[model samples]
Target: MGVTAVLGECARIFTHPRMIFKLAQRELNVDISTDAYIDENRNIEQTIRADERFYLELLVIQAADEEPSTHKIEMYFITYCRKLSHNREASTGPDWRDDRQWIPGINMDNGYFQMHEYQAPAWAQHLNHIPSHIVKLTTLNTPIHRWSLPGVPDRFQVFIKRDDLSGAELSGSKVRILQFLFAEALRQNARHVVTGGCLQSNHCRSVALTCRQFGLTPHIVVARVSKKEELEAKGNALLYRLAGSHLYLSPTCSYESFSQRLRSLAGYISDKYREPCYCIPLGGSSPPGMFAFITLFQELIEQGLFDNFDDIVVSIATGCTAAGIAVGNYLTGSKLRIHAVSIALSKEELTKRIDLMLSDIGLSLGTNDIMDIIDGYIGQGYETITNVSANTGILLDPYYTGKGTQGLLEELKKNPTTFQGKKILFIHTGGKFGLFNGEMDQVMNLPGNHANYINEWPEKDIPLVQ
Candidate 1:
């Protein structure tokens, strides 16, 4: 007879002796010694204390079939484990200076148990957002292609998985973030959603679009752009206006002040209209927001994307996405390397931020191996683009998939042997719409040879005589 069962919260100890003994007796029908002495000195509690939510691991253990087999015949079980906890306050966040001392949390430990089966919603069963005809060009489906740079070896095959192409107005990483935000808003019965970002924020645009989709009004607080700027009408800003989103411009206000202002405005609107308003932090870098990427990881697994790659690279902005991806990777036991490229924060600051995020998700590092923190690409600060990045953007955007590609180029150049024959996938998070606000001109000045294209082409009808 075959035994198959789903375990909830007990899969964390897939390799534990006690777990093995129990499985052998229950599933294999083997008479294992119940009085067998087991070592209790294992710091299982400490390990579990590092990451509470990560305590859940899905395990599939099977006993092979044989004639009169000592082991069971084709017995398999999938279980989840909850790590034990010391119940201590988690460390403030990750330590940027010390990679060796970093510890992830273990708060969700209650021991592994079976999960109850649940049916999918009728509406959810028939819903399909991604078109069936468009082949998903991800790391799992296609071989990564390398972009050649001077002095970089062709052996470095760095391919970008275009998460940016998810949609036109709803393009980029923020789309996934907005999916969760809208779901939560609907759950809370919110009539209006409020958020703030820079003058050219893709996140802000996504929030506006999501609000429109869910029949909720969006109120956006934006910082004023400099008057000297030549704005483009084809990017995210244009889309936001077209979506009929309400915009509020803030001049000479600090981030804290701007947040306070939004709160005050929300209160006034709520009082006036008697409708509930939902406020999201800048860039949607909150705990619930991080679940967007976690859910993405789940989708990737169901699609079998994790089976092909040994490492995954993502462009890090606020660090929430990176943390979520890391936690998801850990939970799934995909064992893929997560290389995060710092775009805004420093190596130290990013580490701390990710650590805090993981803590919020009930997971911890706690002297265990966590994701690799790679900094070195953050040219100046958030939104600051370097000459190389500009060139990359020109080559890769409209597509907004170049900064991470550039970083991958540098990484491959620095250590060609690291990727020797391994496949690498770069997550192309969307920000092309943000780039459309004439910001690229300020960051990436056009070459003198190309100046004629922009300046002389409109005026001159004929080519200049050589």
Candidate 2:
């Protein structure tokens, strides 16, 4: 009853109607319906299937949408209602029980269906008919692996989404944002990139690498942290340097002023060098950059990720990725929740940033964000380190992932009864390099964690290649 339960729900929705009725019968409380919008010519038949263990295996939504395609909001909404028929426990009240509550309102703009809770899907792909054409950053549909922790009450299931393996250099959730940011740069035919982030910012590393690949120069501006040494120390900063990005630093902590200064500097560079310069905001939190997660959430659906988990937890630093995930679920009719744990900012600051991004994308759907924010984690801002990564056997960075994860874990431990039988996904947005700080090793290694390398190191000398 781990993520397999989610897989079951997903599988039932995509399976043939014959299989669905059979599955519903087996489950006793399940319902399957295709009468939401009748286009007899439309095909409810899917080309995907379930696997062993009643798991909801993955499916790649075909990029083509003719009429209420699974890729579109209309069909996804209907399909989600169908799946909700099975998992009726997550929500409460008559509103949750009524299928009509899930029925989308007609899009006044496009005549397409939109959720009552969110704007239409087109707003996600394009803001006011302007395209957010994102470049393909990486082809990593990271797998969700299941891990059970000891000493946790109820033995509730936990699944971790490995975005840490999203790429070799352009790793972490930030790359998803860069996919759109860099695509915009390419669209503008820019020859140089300017961006800002914290000293060890993963977005900076991702942007620098993208610039290297796309033949654009990258200049990074950051305010000084007492931990400025940690930037040269390792992790994302090391990768940023390795990508050969020009570095600009402000000794003061006036980040907004620093961003404006960087903007001015980019203009100067553009004028002096006679090449177009694109300036990216901190953490790539613009509309296009934020829309990358919309693409990512869709990718999760196509990859069958939605079928495997109930909740997704992430570190919400600047709120870009979290905004995407939250909005994507609404746009795509995926009934999933993103639990965003604050890494550095206050919840109000996080909410404000997300709202600002939504405004940028021509949306004013709800005053309340579509996601939940947990801010008990940022005890000393980005300085306090928690060893949750060690206890959970995951590689969480001391500043960001570890501290945030610890907050979530402590809350879960305190309120175990609330999440009983629920499967949670902890997204491991990659910052593996942060494990090594400065020239000195920051984290103590667990015994035998690296033993596999030596034991399986080609048997010392198998044979030289011919």
Candidate 3:
């Protein structure tokens, strides 16, 4: 049907407000009078229709913020639709005529405006379960684009979600989780934000930067292998010094020990400063932080990325990001299998951490049911480089994204049936700063590729003429 015909019919059928308010998800919001609504709906609907390639799901309802008014009653027209392009067969979107799928705001034989509350299905309502108050720390809706792997089969399709571009300094999936963590920290009127991690930890860097932005002192409890490692200021450690973060270096690297130290440090700071100190757990992977990925899953659904990918792979350190995504997938009844490569902990230990995180969020899904924990890729240890050669030209750190992506590629090559011909999305969790930790010295010293270099700027003797 034409845009004008649909909107005109809408006006005649609904016995309610004169103004037609349109809200496009994550985009436009406009309040139009009857004449303006008619004129503008044509352009908006035509843009939305996209030559019938997209089917617009329009929901007409009374504005929940407003009460009934005689002169004018506010009616909202919400537009929602999923993009239809994937390796799998495309889905013909919902049929508007199907009454079961939608509840239209229409009143017959009554001139008075009526309010009809649209109750989303249980799965749809799952998106609303995140923590309400959140600090906007990272850039969201990061682009998801197709990626080219070196040795992948022709049939298989790979995509990368660029969570690494979330922010300049606050880059990575850690910043997303920290959004919730720091929000809670500020809410508690905290003077010092205490967190724990290793020497060159990305999580520690993110926490420190966020604390500086929030005008709170960042106290980082770092687990160190040696005193020299603690003394060296490089990579994320340099950022900690730049942000004026207080570092507490400890010899014990145990998670329990780190937690105890963080609590003790926060308590001491509280007593010394005579102010509240908020202690964020290691990697900010707590119940409050898990909401970051849960909400990110909702963003995927809105962007039409949820239905396209069959499997999602990510690197797991503390297991909070994986748990959040898995919970969101389980709640939405998605068939996507979540695969997490263990960057630090063993499969058993990481699974235990994930299980506990889920339990804190009131979910009780077993490891097998929620995600596929892929181990055997820890290499020498955490923050160490793996020897897998699956170069895709994308900048991934040696710590997290590099290890996780190499694991996925090895799986696709070794056991093709597991992921062959399946659309896969790999989440780049971001640890770019860790690359400068002197791990790639041999590779950097090796012979460089001289074929790409050309003398494009020939001496430029004429430049002095200016």
TM-score of each: 0.58, 0.63, 0.67
TM-score of 3: 0.67
Q: Where does candidate 3 clash, by residue pair?
A: none
Candidate 1 TM-score, C-alpha based? 0.58
For each candidate in the order shown, give its overall lDDT on alpha carbons: 0.53, 0.60, 0.64
Candidate number with the higher lDDT (2 or 3): 3
Cα RMSDs, all models: 18.5, 19.2, 16.2
Q: Clashing pairs in model 2? A: 7-56, 58-304, 59-302, 233-438
lDDT of 2 by residue, 50-117 (tens): 33114221121211112223224334435444564344331121211123322345322331111111
Clashes per candidate, residues 3 or more apart or on different chains:
36, 4, 0
- State the lDDT of candidate 1 residue by residue for 240-291, as single tens digits: 7676777777776665687787788778766766767788777788765666
Query: Worst ten-residue run, lDDT, model 3?
Result: 81-90
Looking at model 2, residue 293 earns an lDDT score of: 75
Best by lDDT: 3
